[model samples]
Target: MTVAATEPRVVAARRRVPRGSARRHIIAAATELFARRGYEATSVQEIVAAAEVTKGALYHWFGSKSELLTSIYRELLAEQTARLRDIAEGPGPVQERLRAAALDVVAHTADHVDELTVWARSAHLLDDEQAEATRRERRAYHDLFRDLVREGQDAGVVRTDVSATVITHMFLSALGNTHTWFRPDGPLTFAEVGEQLVALFVGGLRP
Candidate 1:
């Protein structure tokens, strides 16, 4: 579709463009368009117009559409990973740390559901290098989270019957898919939903 046709729906609801940051605007515009129209349907030209930036500016920030998509995921993952690291290393009992980590990730995902949703839908379209890089970073996050579970298991608080790998995957898969069913206007807010999910996750870990 033409930029004019798509701009209204895509740009109207996006976060306000930051001053002197064409990169953020382009990323924001691309994310909205990708989430609403699917990756394959959004074109470079359309994103430029919607972002109100030149093609040169977009290309300067992102090498290509694939890079932009990967950047979106990387940026979110980086923030989440940093938060997880802090929680994992902070002074707390294993169970408490794990619970806090779980709650934090869910809240972060809920807060950025739109961007995560875009990544979920379009990650497969990324080039091999981009895909592998993201996978590696994601794996690091999972490993850190699994170590927390292992810590709990070793402490004899979390169940030993279930493997840490299995527990981690189950909880994360559920959290990762939250964007699929969650709605801001729904009867229960994501915060409420996240608390319940975290409870279920921590409860399942109990021996």
Candidate 2:
């Protein structure tokens, strides 16, 4: 029998993570610094100082700066993935689920746009192992979404002429790139944008 591939790669945290405010401080500090200054420009020393935590505390929470960055993005993705699973599995028509999923993701990203922007800009700096793991997790998320599209197509609600892959990427691309042009102070609110995008998505899928 062929051996299965290795387990998913996760940036392992140091054992004996103590409960305290230090860990929260380190993450908050790192996120703010990384957003203000590019990831490569930010240093561990700066993070610890800004957090007002000792180097020992930061190290205990995260092994390295890159690991910290990876963990940040991973945490966001984990939340999105969990929410997607719930909407996908819950009772609803396929189109309704798709609309809800799309809107939910757009809203979540808008809420965390700063952290999302940091990841988008610095994700390339991550180590190969951590990066590959994230890619796998993301692919799983995409596959779950694609499955929803396929279900719609099978139900005769979504057009079958367009491939599910195309539909999936088309809508996801629009929603995923919101950080590029979205502005909180801009005329258009995120809720407004989300509603319009959902309308376009659902309309395009109609057979």
Candidate 3:
């Protein structure tokens, strides 16, 4: 007896075939090479070889090396944006929510340090189009944090003297830089470090 192929089965198989996994694999390999060899020294051939994928596949997914780098950075930025949005929209007192938001930012950044490093190094090299896209994506996330801070200030939950933009920028810069000192096997967990950071910035632990 012959078996018939169904649409559902075909779709399921396609989904299970690791849709964007290959792209991520290439990005991971490229990130490692870039970190060790520097962006200019790392070649697409090396990246594909390291990822165990074909040059055609890499090209199909990301048109060029610069595009690949942009895609990877965008992926990391999107993850951060989602985390911040979730925390900002979570149900809690304004101050508590802001603290949670800050902690979430730190945790996500620490968790994806490799991607963060790639972003930090290569982001500035993106061409005008890529740079603009990244800036817009980043600004959307920043605006979310800014709105949250503004709400807190309006409700008298946050200090009224500081501008929301300033507060948001300060929190983002501090959390974004944590990758420099954060260690996966270190004494402090991301959560603990996040809390300490939030307390320092938000609560001002003066008492």
Q: Pick the candidate with the highest TM-score.
A: 1
Which residue pairs show collisions in model 3? none
lDDT of 2 by residue, 62-100 (tens): 999999999888999999999999999989788899888
Question: Could you give the candidate ranking by TM-score, starting with the highest?
Answer: 1, 2, 3
- Error (Å) of candidate 1 at residue 157 is 1.4
Model-by-model lDDT, in order?
0.89, 0.87, 0.79
Q: What is the lDDT of candidate 3?
A: 0.79
lDDT of 3 by residue, 66-109 (tens): 89888877888888888888888888877788777777777776
Runs of candidate 2 with Cα error greater than 4 angstroms are: 1-19
Which is the winner by lDDT between candidate 2 and candidate 3? 2
What TM-score should be assigned to candidate 2?
0.86
Error of 1 at 82 (Å): 0.7
**Which RMSD values do the candidates have, in order?**
8.9, 14.7, 8.9
- In terms of lDDT, the poorest run of 10 residues in model 2 is 12-21
TM-score of 3: 0.81
TM-scores, each model vs. reference: 0.87, 0.86, 0.81
TM-score of 1: 0.87
Clashing pairs in 2: none
Best-fitting candidate, measured by lDDT? 1
